[model samples]
Target chain A: MKIRKINPAGQREPPAERPIKRRATKIHYGMSEIVITIVLVILALVIIIPLVVPLLFSFKTQLEFAYHPWALPKAIRWTNFIEAWKAVRIDQGLLNTLVVCFGSIICTIPPAILAGYVFARYKSRVTEILFYAILIGYFVPVQMVLVPLYRMEVSLKMNDTLYGLFLPMAAFGIPFWTLIFRSFFKSIPREMAESASIDGAGHWRTFFSIMLPLARPATVLAIIQVFMGAWNDYLLSLILLSDQNKFTMQLRVASFLNSYGTDRMPRYAAAVIISALPTLILYLIGHRWIIKGMLSGAIKE
Target chain B: MNVFKRKAVLRTEPAKRKKKDPGRKVFVFLCVLPAILFLAVFLYYPIEETFRLSTMKTTGLSNEVFVGTDNYEKLFRDEEFLAGLRHVFSWAFWSIIIQLPLSFFIAFSLTYYSNKLTKPLQAIFYLPNVLPSAITAMLGKFVFAPNYGLIVSLGKALGWKWLASIDFLGNPDLAFWSVFAVATWAYSGFYVIYLMSRIEQIPKDLREAAELDGASMWCYARKIVLPELNYPLRILAILCTVGSLKLFDLPNMMTMGGPGNATVTLGITLYRHGFINWNYGKAAAIGVVIFVLSLVFTILQFSLGRKEDETI
Candidate 1:
């Protein structure tokens, strides 16, 4: 057996004609790689310490927290959670948050899907104008409407009611959800809709039977985004629901801080953790979908 | 045979399409009407009401006399409102100058120098984003508490006696920066994920080719990565601007815009005027200003983005 070689002019030469030498490329880990990795590790630690330290403080007694603020608890005090839970009315807040989240989701999703489906499938001058009209809703800052909304709520006798918050929350949620659902619906092949029409299915029938079932991912994305928005909302709940009994988790935590004072560091820490736990759990499970939704929403034209 | 048959079918389809169904059009309109009505009631109506209120003087909710631009003039002259605007600009400055770069660096490092630990590290970095802003603000308050705060303890451990009793949130000079720091901590993770997605879109082969040509990492980043990220960076810049202008929750929760309104933002000012002071007209004026400012910025961003696209 003989090895072949190529000449500079691109002609093949016989093995007997000449011998060639090849240099092996070596891969090495240099100082730059080490420096970059170390820098990244430091950055990661900076982000993690802030999140984890508060949890550790939550387990300590007030004295323990004061004495060794940076140390892990020598003995975990589960009573801190109980104390914080009662002081902050975590049970009521949690219940209100759940109700608001569910109400907003139920109110927002169906209308958003219907509107999105229509926008995606139907084309006309009216639909185009209506679509842009709704898109403008995306840029309207909540501050611009807060005063009027308050007045409206007062006049309508909807202030301090869960349903009052639900209506506006669902309304604010529509623009984003409609945009997401519209894009998702547009991605579905038109052939499905045409075939459904050929089969004599009405618009609602086609949407319910074909489009909604295929929009599972978008639905999940919408639910997660809207649930987090409504659950974590602070300013709206603060202004709208002044009744302590109707307070959401965010308002409860804020009120706890104001009333409980800063001396009770451990209890405050516990309250903070409890307030954030649901969102944390949701993110841990559905982070991929959350990131996907965020990126798609941001980058989409 | 298939082509001939499709031609015959295509010729007959247009004749059948001549009969348009008004019922289908009406059904489509009905499907979209609910959303339109919701927006009109909840969104557009309030905006129009804000504009109307801004032009009037309200004693209570009912008594209104058109005052022309008096409220707007008062907004510019009001010291606290001016301070709120200044603080928001400062927040935007820090966000654009510091937070954006920090997030970009983390994202770039994670993508280019990733190893087995990268995935877990990304999740950890983004942990703050998943938590409630209110919780994060509370956590920030605890971290900067005068006596037992993590910062105070760290300073004491490092033999810095001056930090032993420094009040971060109570000092007028330090309150705004303190709240700004917490805002950065809570939200920078969002941008990290955003920039990471953009960086991921850059072609892998391009980077590899540059490396094979003996281009240094700095050269590769400057020549290939930065240019590729141009559009997302622009979008992120606009988002950062609009988002900072709307800053409310963290400052409201952490400091209540306290220490003499040091951390007050436009949103906080609106909240104060309407809810606390019961000056609906003044608050409506502030609301109008914020809306106009955000709209102007958005329009500028779009036009700038279009120009860049054309130039490229």
Candidate 2:
């Protein structure tokens, strides 16, 4: 956490030597900076074009896009949005999405907290072994488990139900959630728990009343992340819920695109936008926490 | 105190002297049992099944015979399977070549620009990571249509037919790059965000010291920042390597390894064999191959990652 002072220009680092040669090289480079800038700008365009163009095209009349492929729509076509929404039964699918998101969170987060507590608070070797055994699940590809999960669901008569999607989603997410919560819990000073213990509070009382309150920030971040994951998931919903009525938004969008054909491309675009709205809103509100959470998990290494 | 202790001793029952709390034990069990059961049924069980299926031969509606290592043998001889492996390697090769450096450059710019434009620029770049791969691929498909793509327009103006001259996803030589491009676009942002975080963590003293010594921007960048980014770069290399080996979505979504198996990767090949063709045994064999490859690379990754951490 301590700060250090280092100058960018005057450092003894080998890279500092290039400044004198930089000007001469620039002249020799012959408008190379401009070219490079243009090239990078184009590359940026290429990367962003797909995300932007369709969004624009989805608003224009197909005829307009055909006539002027690069121009903005002369008129805003609100109907395209509605048509796509209705075509996908966005209403029902949104409800289904909400259910899966909240349901999975409901099923997973508490267990993650409890498991995390055990892993954090206990010293038994069995706990460590059990925790690693669970961690192995995170490495296996979802495809590898899909067929077996499907078969099991069928046998259990849970197929095509919200619970079917909820169970697997929750199961897959627990390892990550548990890891996050454990890390959070580990960061909390044990003195707090000891103090509570000395005060004659039960372990459960200390955990719920003291430690849980301390973990609120991490808990909020976890819930948002787990919700986004469950909400945006496609392959699980694709395999589990065969019925249209039961489909989550992602599967519904795929089905809508397939059935509607390309003529209604605008509507498909609208459907895609609608499908992504919850995530977009979630990101806008909690973008800081999401990025920080991801960095904490991935880049801390 | 002696009198009080005597009274307490008299009141203490022998039955309660050795009482132990069962609550914590029950709590541990309750917390872990569901996850264990889930993994056993869902992950480990399927893996065991895949291993079993790899060694078996089936002929009838309900027939399976043990045939040790035969599926793996067939896998090597299958030209298509080998082609898939080659395909995956090529895609990974191109993605690493283009995406890694590009991500670093973007990260560098985001960190170094250090001006009014930084936050908005970083946010703009982070957009692709949140959007699902499905949407990203679909958008890539839209932009790559020769007549519609901006590149096609530029090519037309330049009197070049690069857009129409090459079938992006149809040609064997070109489809790999097409899928790789999409992969790069989607993942480069992720790496950029990753590296930017690391860059931010680099002690400012290094930069200040370099600056005090009259280090040019380029010098400071090449010597100071790049060295600092070494750990993440190594991580990115391992991640991209294994990720490309197990590459599935972009290829599957954009090309479906298509225009005649041009972009078919190990993952797509596994799916095509196991799920599509109902060749469960062969698919399982391919799964075993992928699993082996991933395991070896992952172990290597962990070691390298560990060493990098130790140095840091």
Candidate 3:
């Protein structure tokens, strides 16, 4: 039995509460530090300007935008945002994207979690092959399946519907989450299930009451990752869903901007902003969870 | 011989089944059923269909005419597809060299520099990745747009008339690199956070312990941090390569694989063939090649990752 190192809040225990380690603290108010800070600040400003440039242009008039390299807008153009919102039909797109996110999570998460538990606990030749077989799906590029999926969806009369888009999105999500959850379930001690069984709890009873609750963090991580995947997806939604009314934020925004005939610069900027702002705000509020979920699943358990 | 083999399997299976509950098979079946349904119906079936499509002349207006391996022959002879493949390798190469090291350097600086600035600076750098790539590409376009763009306007202000006159995205070769530079800028922040967090995961006391042992900061980093980071760096490198292989949205939205196919990735090639040209057979052939290449990468990733696990 592997002992679980239950480290709470990621804090390591102090090394005998040591003293006289000024050298280890490593530099205070030095020239190198100042140089590093100046260099990094400049680098940060330059790198951040891509996202910031759109926001700046979204405010500027066409004439003003053409002339200014870097300037505060002479007058803020809320009209630009307004026009972008109408042009992209972002309100509808937002509604559809939320449906995709939740719809995908619902379609995939429960089944993946159940499948993950069995794969983690059971040992057999058949299960091992099944596990790797399902994992192979995760490796396929969406491009590989595009033509056939289109044909399949149309034949089933599932094309141009919200469920049609989300179902396939969930199909891809299931393999990935199954991998994450299996790793998580493996970290759990088998003794919990064994004891429950000893106390006459059936497999279903032990799983539902005990194992499921224990996997709350992993489940939330899977939810956030799946939600983000569905949120940021452009290709699948672009191809599979044709109705303008049902377009996801990415599809609508990309189609609006990528119209080859004209460059609607200010509106393009605004539409891009409208498309991205909510998620950036959400990311700000939830960075800890997002980072933890993203890295912790694939890299570490 | 088959009956004897069955008898051997049955004899071993019964011994292994002695402690198994009657409900075990049912429970396992319930757990596995949904995944099997999805993997089979959606993913695996579609893959097979892609292979089947590759052997035909599919237009959907007419019946798919079986062309055997002729489509594959045409694709191999196609210069555009080969160029796209070269572009993918180049993109992956640049990402691993330029982007990975940039992430590593900044992460090193941030961790060693000061305590107060790390959080805010990290947040600002990480802001790029939060938005969609469609937005990232569009934003990148305005910055590099000719005549009245960011680079040119700044150049004109600085009295560099040649820089202002240059059209970064209009030229074929330049367009590819400009998009590459933009991607590296947008994505480096993500890996910076990855590296920094990995650095942060090393216990505080361990650093102090190294210091107590008379090791300098550089010595500690080289000895402790670098070795610890080796595997994760390898994994991130593979991910970057895989991501480059799937390069679609950024190049697609930014350049539209334009100025005569300068920035066309395998993905863009596939998309154009299927949707734009209305030729699904050639597209599916490209898809099979991509699928094979990525499977190679995935298997490499798994084997490398598993090798580390064995050591642990």
Candidate 4:
């Protein structure tokens, strides 16, 4: 009877262990796994080729591009970039874009941090309503406000100026950034605030000294998102700023495309690359943070 | 008298705490005041103005005589405006049909079967998203150029003679699809990353348990993974719809909504009406329509999704 019981128990153990081993092995090198890997590689190539093609085309002359559109450049044409720079006046555009991006960031971050702290910590009916009211700003499309905004800018004599762009961009950025900041602040323990208050620090003092320092991750996330948005903005810049000299990189690139009309492929390619260089470099360095910030809104538990 | 005294003491204690922190209310107000004021001016004021302007007849931004519903009437009758609405729906439809599935596939593959190549591949997929929309538009223009474009060259190499003369952006029927294709290519990477992040959050032990139960990959994904992803997917659907309504830059840059209003989305139409034709009133009407449509669609989607959840 002992032998019989042992045999049945031992048989059950091996069966359970066998299936897990089988599953482990199947996950590692099955035919389905191989097929999925191959498919993923193909999909990766599809995405990579489009991006890399433009970069490669930027280095070739128009003649080389026309003759061998798929091949790498035989001789690099560095002047393509120079001509593109002159044609688009990208130096001016880049400077304007940088100013707008940084200025808007400066305008947006502090207000967001302050407002977010208040909304996150303070509990009241009025504050709750006000928080939702601010969130309504997120749903308002830029299209809905473009006409009136243009009029407002013109009447205020803010049209065609970088500061003009900065104000609206910063204003529009507030709702989303505030939401991110509020969520981050909420994650901190209430005791932190209570201790500060007990130690004789006021709201602003505690916020500036302690809370703000703890909010580095959210701040980094906000800065990256806001900078990218301001940098890549095309519609507002196009409508609000009429002056050729004040065009952002996107606006300059659009007008350049219209005038260049696809004839100067190499030059246009170079212009595209140059316009995207700053954001691309930033993205390469801070992609993880950017992705985290972006997914925060959708993935909140 | 004793019960009354106890109640009095309780009320007084809380009142005393409130009196001690009287500065907190003022401080909160000061903290939120700037953002509230800024949003009120730039965002809320303009939205209110757009609604007000939509009801009036105006040559430009000023001299509004309220001709109620005239602009809305004109908008419905306008062929370009109607076409713009149709194009936006189609764009949204195609985005849901094409972009969502493709992104899900790529994201699922990367998350489930991660290898050394996953990081580099993820970066490459997201490259288009980081690039300026103008550059993305330009790349589309290059790829579809009839003369020396990659598509044409590849077609020739494959001996597909019909593609040599195809003007993808210039043709009316093709212009809309071409812009849609470019948008899908440019934006899918963003969704891939989004879904991948969500998928990554699923507990490894659960997945292992499913595997140990001898669950097929499809069974595991369908039974376990997809249910967890339902909420994020719903959010994604709403974003995709709203985003499609706001499609402007690519169509504006590539075809300029050309070949007879083929690719003109609501945003492009509003832009042209306001800035190009200087018809502020008509533009405002279109803006109202876009807003209403987006709001209605979001409500409908939520209701529909809720019903599905209830049934499940």
Residue range A1-301, candidate 2, lDDT tens digits: 0112255555355655566655665564346444544554565666555655557767877666556646677888888888877877767877898999899988778888888887888768899998888777656666555545665677788889998898788888887778777867887889999888668776678888999999887777677777767865776786688888998766665666456544445655566677666666776787777776666556433
lDDT string for model 3 (B83-134, tens) is 7899999999999999988888788789876578888898877777767777
Best by DockQ: 4
Poorly placed runs, candidate 1 (over 4 Å) = A1-30, A70-74, B1-20, B301-312
Cα misplacement distance, residue B162 of candidate 1 (Å): 1.9
Candidate DockQ scores, in order: 0.55, 0.29, 0.49, 0.57
- Displacement of residue B271 (Cα, Å) in model 2 is 2.2
- lDDT, residue A97, model 3: 92
Better of 2 and 4 by DockQ: 4
For B175-215, candidate 1 gives per-residue lDDT tens digits of 98888888788888888988898898787999878866757
- The residue pairs that clash in candidate 1, if any, are none
Best first by TM-score, ranked: 4, 1, 3, 2
Chain A TM-score, candidate 1?
A: 0.83
Per model, how much of the real contact set is kept?
0.65, 0.23, 0.62, 0.66
Residue A226 shift from truth in candidate 3, angstroms: 0.6
Candidate 4 on A180-220: residue-level lDDT in tens? Answer: 78878988999998899788887778898999999987788
Candidate closer to the true structure by DockQ (higher is better), 3 or 4: 4
* lDDT score at residue B48, model 2, on the 0-100 scale: 84
lDDT of 2 by residue, B201-243 (tens): 8999998788657576678889999988777787888788887
* lDDT (Cα, tens digit) per residue for candidate 1, span A59-98: 9988887777778799878988998888888778889988
